[model samples]
Target chain A: MNWDAIFTSLRLASLTSLILLVLSLPLAAWLAFSRWRWRFLIESVVALPLVLPPTVLGFYILTAMGSRSPLGRWYADLIGSPLPFTFEGLVFASVIYSLPFAVQPMASSFAAVDRNLVEVSWTLGISRLATFFRLILPSAKNGVVTALVLTFAHTIGEFGVVLMVGGNIEGVTRTVSIDIYDQVQDLNYAAASRTSLVLLLFSFIVLAVVYSLNRNSPLWPTLRKR
Target chain B: MADAEKTMTNGARPLQVSIKRNFAGRFLLDVSFNVGAGPGTVLVIFGPSGSGKTTVLRCLAGLESVDEGTIRFDGEAWSDTAGKVFVIPQKRNIGYVPQDYALFPHLSVRGNVEYGIPRARREAEGPWIDRLLLILGLTDLQQALPGSISGGQRQRVALARALARRPRLLLLDEPLSALDAPTRSVLRFELRRQLKQLDVPAVLVTHDWEDALGLGDQMIVLSGGRLLQSGSPLDILTKPENLAVASVVGVETVVPGRRVRRERGIAQVQVAGLNLWAADIDQPGDEVYVCIRAENVTLEIGSATKSSARNHLPGVLLGVVAAGPLMRVKVDVGFHVDALVTRQAVEDLDLKVGSPVGISIKATAIHLIPR
Candidate 1:
């Protein structure tokens, strides 16, 4: 097994899901509750990655982070290095690619909460920010967990975006999906099959955990009975 | 106007609201009323389901904004469209119990009640919260979740949570409408007693007239998003200001009449070509509507001569319907007049359909509103 590729994927997925969690909480809240006139435009922009081809999204992101672009130039000025073909660039691309996975579930769950509970919180002299933390976050716990898990798994399975922006650097940006493609290119069928099996087993376990968390029945019903 | 000046000079700040809100294709809510400040002062916004009673309560709580006019509570401008002054609901310091009670499902009853207190003040305010729970009878269920409690218990938890914060004003929207009939009737008195003991001025909204009469010190009748009348509950029940108010107050007999002459303190009005005497008013209009409650009309078997009632009309009884403990007798005396009497009275008078009877109404019992 390609252990270095596995560890890099874990690091990138963990960091990307953490950043998305912090960013998506308030964004999803605003999407669920704001009464702004043009809110659908923002919603569409956030959901663009869900339907668009990953290569197309990667191409735009690549163009935006090229040496000639303003963001690319500002980052190089600050960190004394370019943004393309690095682990940081891969993290950035994966975050954009998996944003809809993080936001949609959280927003829907927040919207499903009884609005009177929120209004009652405000009437009790609790500020909106405090109410969000005290009432809304706890109430939407399952959706929040779902968002984190999906974002992590989606980032781990990303292939096209990482290859486009981060390139095939061995330890820097070569994640498990890119390692599988490299093994197949080299005619190493045994290594490729082994990696694919691990991925399939890991995805099944992740989904099992998600479904169990969402179920109303206890996961270990026999133990519960005892 | 004189009463307004009197309330203002006593150093008490009454809640004064005058607002106009448009719900696009729904209706235009235009109302203005005042709630006196003191313990045991409850102002009920009484109306039917679609009559914008909740809208008025929401505007008062700052949950819903008004499109025009102002809402001033305790001399502070909570909302003023012309001046662009609006206080958000968080800063309003209000205790609001919504229609469903809206207990926090994720928290224990104690946690729900302790939610409004600041984290730094929780330790200090623990005793106060305990007192609130004891008063509302939620002490035994403090550790239970809202879902595990009964409906009445959940309502008490909601009330305890609202009162824990010691808000400046309390707002309740159909507080007892979600319970069963038996529970609702029992909670009606319990809620009124709690509000009086808490000594906080409240604004309550309800479609049920019994809630309005049993719980309110002052009542405002609303219909079709318009303010029909504002007065004491007894005053509004006995003397509504207009036809709409009469209908909302459930006054059963309202007939159009024309004033024929005025003598001393009484006016002789002709209704269905029959003369009826009412207390005189100074209004110049001759056209009016005479309103009477069914309970105020007395039925006689024959021509009764020993009573002091001013108007007596002899007609045939049209219908007799059993209504709870009383019998509703309808008599066609020029116009149909309804009288509510006990079944024993009905049996003693031998009241049957197509039988001759005399209906007597006191001059003071007849209320006149301009047509």
Candidate 2:
């Protein structure tokens, strides 16, 4: 099996997870607290990626980032490289494809936080920024961990979107899923089985660690005898 | 103006709050009151649920802004809707203890208490923190998180955290409402003592009249988001403005009656097909409600004796309910009259359902409110 494809997949997943986490924190907070009339519009738009066919989403991203598009031309002018079939392009597509995975759980967790906590913090003379870091983030740790794990796993296992947008380039864009696809197409059953087994086992282990941590989380130590 | 001057000269910065807001076209709250800012002075806003009591506290704390009018805390405008002066809650320097305590579940007791204290000045206020922990009886549990502690401890931690910042005004919204009965009883007195020691202007909102009567030096009654009345607790209890105020204050029984005669500021009324007399009952021929407290009704087993309490009615016992130290004995004298007597009284008098008993209420105890 190709090790460069495995390393590229890991790099893409980690970068996508970290960037999505940072970008979605404020978005999830807004979704949780805002009473705007048009809030559901933004929510449905974010969740669109979850239901759309991965190739369809990739096709849209590819169209948006084509050299003919204004953003694609501007970015291509700003940078020396063209947009399609690059590691950066793959990471950007993965972020959008996995946006709902990072945002939904985060929004739910933030909504679960007692509104009284925020109000009391404000009354105690704590600023909103301080309260978010000091109170909200700590309370919503489980959801944040879930978001990270899901985003990383989802990005690692992505095939159709990366194939459509990143085009299965040998070392740069070919991830483990794309490698397994190529091995299967080349009629190398042994290599395809090995890579697929590795992906399945890795996803299981990550999910197991997350679930075990959730079971022992400080917020709900259900096994402890009071 | 004179009251404000007197309070200011005595080193007490009186809080003058007057504000109005239209809440979703359901209720319009218009309130104006003043409470002297000093130790041992608690201004309680007492009303039932959805009566705008908590809203008043929130408005003062800057958690909720008012639509019109100004809120002056020691002559500094915290909110002026027309003048465009709106101070955020963080800048108001107010301590607010909500109903759920709202302790930080992630932080240790000490960490939560010190959260509001300026970190740069935390070391200098170490003794103050120690004093608070000791006074609140939380020294041993200082390192524990809120979830690991009892309800009362969480409440103390929330209060300590609020006080750590040395707020100018304190707002307590039903601080003891979430606790069990025994804890609530114990914390009520302890909270009152601590609030007195803090010596800051406070506005406590509670739906429970017991909290208001026990902790409030002065009280305001709110119903349907309007200020019904404001006075001493005893005054509000003895003379509510209308039937709504009387009901919210938890007057045991209110009997609609027509005044039959008036003599020496005392009026005799026909109520529920029975004759009753009440003092401070001027304007004969006026419709009124005779509000009687259950605690004021005394139970007797036999015939009426020569006593100062002139309003005695013979009735049969309807039912008996043991409520803590007192037993609520419902007596039927044409209408049901609840008399809160001791459990020993029930046992001593052998009073049960259908047993003959006498309910004696003093004429002066009857609070007459115009219908």
**For candidate 1, lDDT tens digit of each residue in B180-213?**
8889889999999999998777889998878998
Candidate 2 Cα errors over 4 Å, as ranges: A217-226, B1-8, B257-277, B281-287
Error of 1 at A178 (Å): 2.9
In CAPRI terms, where does candidate 2 land? high
Model 1 steric clash pairs: none
Worst 10 residues of 1 chain A by lDDT: A217-226
The alpha-carbon deviation from the true structure for residue B45 of candidate 1, after best TM-score superposition, in angstroms, is 2.0
> What DockQ does predicted model 1 obtain?
0.70
TM-score of 1: 0.86
Model 2 lDDT per residue over B241-323, tens place: 78888888988888888888888877888898899988765543479888899999999878787788979899999999987
Model 2 agreement with the true structure over A73-139: per-residue lDDT tens digits: 9889999778899999999999999999999888888888888888888877789988888889898
Question: What TM-score does chain B alone reach in each candidate, compared with the true chain B?
Answer: 0.88, 0.92
- What is the Å distance of residue A193 in model 2 from its true position? 1.1
lDDT of 1 at B182: 83
TM-score of each: 0.86, 0.93
Task: Go through the candidates in order and give each one's DockQ.
Answer: 0.70, 0.82
Task: Determine the C-alpha RMSD for candidate 2 after optimal superposition of all C-alphas.
Answer: 2.9
